[model samples]
Target: MTTSAKRLDSAARRAQLLDVADRVFTAHGVHAPLDLIVEMAGVGRATLYRQFPDRHMLLLALMERSAQWLATRARRLAHRDDAFFRLLDYMASRIVRSPALSDYWRTTRMSDPRFSDVYQEVLNAFAPPVARAQRAGLLHADVRADDIPLLASMLAAGLRGETDAERRQLVGRALCIVQRGLTPSAPGGCLPGTVNDLS
Candidate 1:
């Protein structure tokens, strides 16, 4: 094959591996067997190794992709004038959709500088609305930009629930409490649809 053909093949194989890896990792965590991923991807071991080299490298790639997707969503959310509420709503939606955030925190090696860098990028992506809310006095006085991470971490735990119903209930409850705590007292009570309430 020509060099151009080989490059295209390599790129196609890498995309296949990532698609398989997302399912495998979600089911078995990041340490799932390399042979299993290669088999599922319908690619040879050589192709897998050529693309990812190791489990850590594959995990980092997944993190990078997920972070890019999330940054795009966050940027859109920040366009809303209600930065505080929009940030929390964005976070709540993430908690419902992505279980990997919590899984990565629990399973990945925290000491890995690459992993730490990815986590930092996620935090920075989440910071804009949080900082804006603070400046606007929309968030509680005690809240810091760093506090958004803990909120996300907690919501992520809710998503790790064993069953679909459980995950839904947990996230719903957590979001309620979060919005109540963050809202200014002037808006009635914690009832949903009220000006101050956040469901």
Candidate 2:
């Protein structure tokens, strides 16, 4: 094959691999076998190894994809006039939609330093919006940019209940408390259905 054709083929294979990895990782966690990913991706073992030298490399790729997915969600929710509230709503909706993300997060943290680096890169993309929200007096001024990750952890912990309804209530109550603390002057209490505009 010509060089150009070779490059295109490589790009296509990479995309296909990542798509399949997403499904397998979500269902089986990061510890899932390499053969499982290869089978799911419909690629030979040689092809998988050629693309990703080892399991770590494949996990890193998946982490990058997951981070980009999250940053996209945050950007979409950043449209509200109140940047702070919008960010909180975005995070709340994100938590509700993908409870599995926390598992991936823990896996990333346990992986190589490069994994943490990529995770931070993705988190940074969403930080500017949070900062802007704080500046607009919509988000709690005391809430530092670094606190977002901690907040995510706390929210995820609260959502670790047995039943879906219990998890939902935990998340809702956590968001309400956080929002209220952020907007003390607002007369009305945390009403349901108002926060998750981005959802």
Candidate 3:
């Protein structure tokens, strides 16, 4: 095979492995055996290690990829009048569909400071839309941008079903309830508590 073709093949294989890893990690969690990933990807152990030197590296890549995906969606919705709610819905859907990822985040406290930078980027993406929603009185005046993740987590907790369709339905119901609570009771009305109030 040509060198260029071989290079393409290598890139494709790496992506394929990452794709499999995403599914396996989501189904099993970050600490799941590498053998499951290799088996699912139809790749050998050497290939897995070659693509990702170790499990931590693989987990980091997965987390970064997931964060990037959400950030991209948030960016697209940034200009909408209800961007905050749209982003919340987007996150709720993702969490319900990827329960393993939700569980992983809940169970593992990311100790690495570098991961905080990624988290900050996501928070930044969420801020403008949240501010817009508050200014427009679509959301309660007391709601802070930082509260978005907590609200999303609460909604995500309600997701459950035997199948993807069922899970989506459950998440939809949960979001509906949460959205109603989030909406201002009257124009410019504030919720009883702000983010600081919780603390």
Number of backbone collisions per candidate, in order?
0, 0, 0
Tens digit of lDDT per residue, candidate 2, span 72-178? 76677676546545555556655655455455564344245676676676567667776777667666667766676666666666447556566667777777777
- Cα lDDT of model 1 overall? 0.68
For each candidate in the order shown, give its overall lDDT on alpha carbons.
0.68, 0.67, 0.72
Worst lDDT 10-window in candidate 1: 190-199
Model 1, C-alpha of 142: deviation from truth (Å): 3.3
Candidate 3: misplaced stretches above 4 Å? 1-12, 28-31, 110-114, 159-166, 186-199
User: Model 3 compared with the native: what TM-score?
Assistant: 0.77
Q: Which candidate should be chosen as best, given TM-score against the real structure?
A: 3
Best by lDDT: 3
**What lDDT does candidate 1 reach at residue 161?**
78
Candidate 2 residue 132 Cα shift, in angstroms, is 1.7
Q: Better model by lDDT, 1 or 2?
A: 1
Tens-digit lDDT track of model 3 for 72-110: 987888778888877777777667657666656544544
